[model samples]
Target: MGIRSVMLPAAIAATLCAGGVARAEGLTVGFSQIGSESGWRAAETTVTRQEAKKNGDTVKIADAQQKQENQIKAIRSFIAQGVDGIFLAPVVATGWTQVLTEAKDAKIPVILLDRDIDPADKALYLTAVTSDSVHEGQVAGDWLVKAVGSKPCNVVEIEGTVGASVAANRKKGFDDAVAKDPNIKIIRSETGDFTRSQGKQVMESFIKSVGGKNICAVYAHNDDMMIGAIQAMKEAGLKPGQDILTVSVDSVPDMFKAMMAHEANATVELTPDMAGPAFQALNAYKKSGTVPPKWIETKSTLHTSQDSDLQQIYDEKKNLGY
Candidate 1:
């Protein structure tokens, strides 16, 4: 994810050494989460704690409930407590210069998960562990193009929270990919705020404005929104997969279940184990003063019901707290 459409710089540097490395032994790390707004966020928190346990680190988690103010407050609290490190899943991209600068002044390293901060000043954080959201969106768009072939398809888009780096980047990737073919056109688009209720509400408005039957597909930034869109489609007396193709990001359990039921098409996997790499970087930096690369990328895999065993994947990820 980016404050810009492009990815962050890939330069590895000693900027991480600005804050003295963490002390050996059980370290206390504060985590400022974006909140359990979706299944993926919940699984991310769960996996973060699991990663902390694996590293014998004490994680002090603060739920921001998807507010920038709450996240800034949580980071200040972590700094006041003098935690060894901080894990921040930023609710939005900009307006972070002040708090992040404060963290730097306190000599606390902040590792970003899921979202990236504005690169106006990259020195504020240590490093970011994130997936290629643009690529994820491109994958979704590519799948839709191939599925529809040369047939004219009108798509309604369910976007994530506005101003989020991930949301902007995903939209850019999808928009760019779909631009390659004039046959695929996005007819309606709105922000779902990355919530199911808002997603359904937006889809409902889209259906009324555009004539549901005229729309060929729905592109959601996340699976939760796609599931909500599917519900809206069903309630409106339309078969989801058959009547309107569903393509979204975030391969959560419910998405796979919908896939098994043939209600959704494809979802690009946004792994919840973001903490795995964040903790790894923290540990390495603490133990031996290792400065990891500026951006640590996690793989984004595309899952489709048509080519894969949806049930087996659902069974594997159902217990993952998503």
Candidate 2:
């Protein structure tokens, strides 16, 4: 196996100190990541490792490559190895009952990071550390509504992977928000699988079908998709931020850079430090037998180029594995 290097800031070194954790050091946890599907995913993986190393804990990782079966296998392997705990970034929202049950039977706690599974049983995992994906979509939609107030703006949306809870909720949130404004309508929608190339390809097809001039703005499920859509629009001789509005999620460093360049309008921030809270909960549980809540909801804030320190933020986060 080869090593992928990443640089975490000094402040993140103490990330696991939250919730009055009882210093549960040297615990070995297994992480089943959903592959490096996007820049934010890679950054989340890096931050997970960085936080674990800070507290002298060990992390054994399995790259699921965006497949639920692989993640199931990884969880079973972690259980067999008697790891202290497991961290799961589920590829999809369902098909987790048997594997999660196995982990529970083995008396190993599992923490979900960056996403949630279906709420078939809340006892399946200790807690979910994720942002409100639905709200993220709403944030984008609200921003676009305010940007083009009361105009007959036709929106073309690029969705994430099918069956993923984030995708479903984001789509619903955006659609619900825009439904309030009769003038802002979604003319076209399709899955981009949360990848840049696929986003660009989908945007190209949307442009050809709907005509870029008639389309008013673009809303992508994530910023990686937005970046690709921006490229596609430029290739078609459409000025993206100016001629057609842009909004998406994930305040990654690249998105901030684009905002500075005035190519992308707005993004919702999805922090990659999910492991920090997960580790804290595990530490508190192991040392004091306290059960963490079923869901640890993270914040989803909006960002735009109008911010005073966009460039500084871009420079700071450039090496965070994004």
Candidate 3:
């Protein structure tokens, strides 16, 4: 991975030490969430809050509830409270400069989780922790290519939110991999906002417009959308995994159930362990005056129908909300 580095001034370093555990309640953190929209997102919030409770750290939790303005308001409030650190799951990559700049001017170290901000001003924030979205997308695309072999395929894509890094990077990775295989063509593509209802609605339209036989597969940015598409296929009197090849990111329980039932082919894993590493970084930076790289890429896994371990994890994790 390429380096995305940020440097803190020595003068600020001295101030950082002054606001140590005694002053900030031993690593008080302010966390801003995008929203509990999908299973993966819910898992992320659940894991983060649980980790904070386990550590007995004072964490101010703010739910943006899928609104960028709400996220901005919560962050500014965290800044006002003089929290030791800040964590932001930005709604949109752009338009974050003002709020991030506010944190910087206040000398508060900021950690980005999940999504990322525009790289035009790298010094405005501390670092980010997120999945390698491009790689995850490529995994899905590659799996589809191998499964279908050289057969001509027509595919429809259900995209996530626009302008988000996950949406952009995942799309780029999938397109790059699919481009290598000339026989596969994307017949239709639309945004589902990473929600089940939206995914189902989009699939309904695709089925009506192109009919079931024309589409060989469905590539959704997340599992929720894929699940929605699967329902639409069933209602249209078409099989999902068998009649139309399906692949997506996020190995939620429903996807596993679909895989077991032979309605969904495969999914790449997105773990809720994101907060553990972020908090570890924050603790290290605070206690020892250590600064991490600007970008910390989280790990992911690809699960096919053959992986028993995936099925186990899926079954266990599904019941627990994120």
Top candidate by lDDT: 1
Show the lowest summed lDDT stretch of 10 residues, model 2.
Answer: 1-10
- In order of lDDT, best first, we have 1, 2, 3
For lDDT, candidate 2 versus 3, the one ahead is: 2
lDDT of 1 by residue, 1-322 (tens): 5743343332211223333244447788999999997677888988888889998888989998889999999998788667889999988779999988899998889999988878578888889999998998899999998999999999999999999878998999999999998999999999998888998999888888998899999999988788889999998888999999999998989988898899988899989989999999998888899999989999888888785678888887887788
Q: Which ten residues in a row have the lowest lDDT in candidate 3?
A: 1-10
Backbone clash total, candidate 1: 0
Residues 1-322, candidate 3: write the lDDT tens digits.
1232223454454465455435535578899998888667888888887777777676778999989999999988777667878988888878888888899898888999987888579988888998888999998899988988989999899999887668888899999999999999998989999889999999999999998899999999999999999999999999998899899998888888889888888898887767877888888888897998999988878887766776687667776583
- Error (Å) of candidate 3 at residue 71 is 4.5
Candidate 2 segments whose C-alpha is farther than 4 A from its true place = 1-26, 64-82, 91-102, 118-121, 161-165, 191-193, 201-211
TM-score of each: 0.75, 0.77, 0.77
Which pairs of residues clash in candidate 1, taking residues 3 or more apart in a chain or in different chains?
none
Better of 1 and 2 by TM-score: 2
RMSD (Å) per prediction: 10.2, 9.1, 8.7
lDDT of 2: 0.87
